[model samples]
Target: MTNPLKTQVLIKIDTITYKGHSVIRINIPPQKEISFVGEKAFIREDSSTVEAKGPKLLAVSQLFQK
Candidate 1:
């Protein structure tokens, strides 16, 4: 399953039996900083994540340019 944080993080999960008891083990790798979405960029404003538009979009592009 993917991480709930929406980083598209990959996870490894397994089930094991120990002493007649079942246990679940989850392994989560590190996550990297998220650049804007591939198709469209987004910015957070006032506790909200909104699509970058107009000036905001340009600013985002400039800030994140490789």
Candidate 2:
């Protein structure tokens, strides 16, 4: 059987902790799906590829938000 559909997204923040953690706050909308794979993260929207980025996923997400 096919897996349930899920849309994922990674948000970009402008700050980070010294521990190398992302400080960017994100507000994911309902019905969207998101997942993080190591430094890279992936997001899907309505069964379509939305985004994929490295540790700096937020930075990339910001670009698309604009």
TM-score of each: 0.39, 0.22
As a whole number from 0 to 100, the lDDT of residue 43 in candidate 2 is: 61
Q: Candidate 2: list runs displaced more than 4 Å.
A: 1-35, 54-66
Cα lDDT, all candidates: 0.62, 0.49
User: Root-mean-square deviation of each candidate, in angstroms?
Assistant: 9.1, 15.5
Q: Which lDDT value does model 1 have at 12?
A: 67
Q: What is the lDDT of candidate 2?
A: 0.49
Model 2 residue 10 lDDT score: 43
**Candidate 1 Cα deviation (angstroms), residue 14:** 15
In candidate 1, what are the lDDT values of residues 1-66, reduced to their tens digit? 224534433346678999999998666454333344556666779999798878887776666455
How many residue pairs clash in each candidate at the backbone level?
Answer: 0, 6
* Residue range 1-66, candidate 2, lDDT tens digits: 013322322442245565777576644544333444444565655788655656456665565564
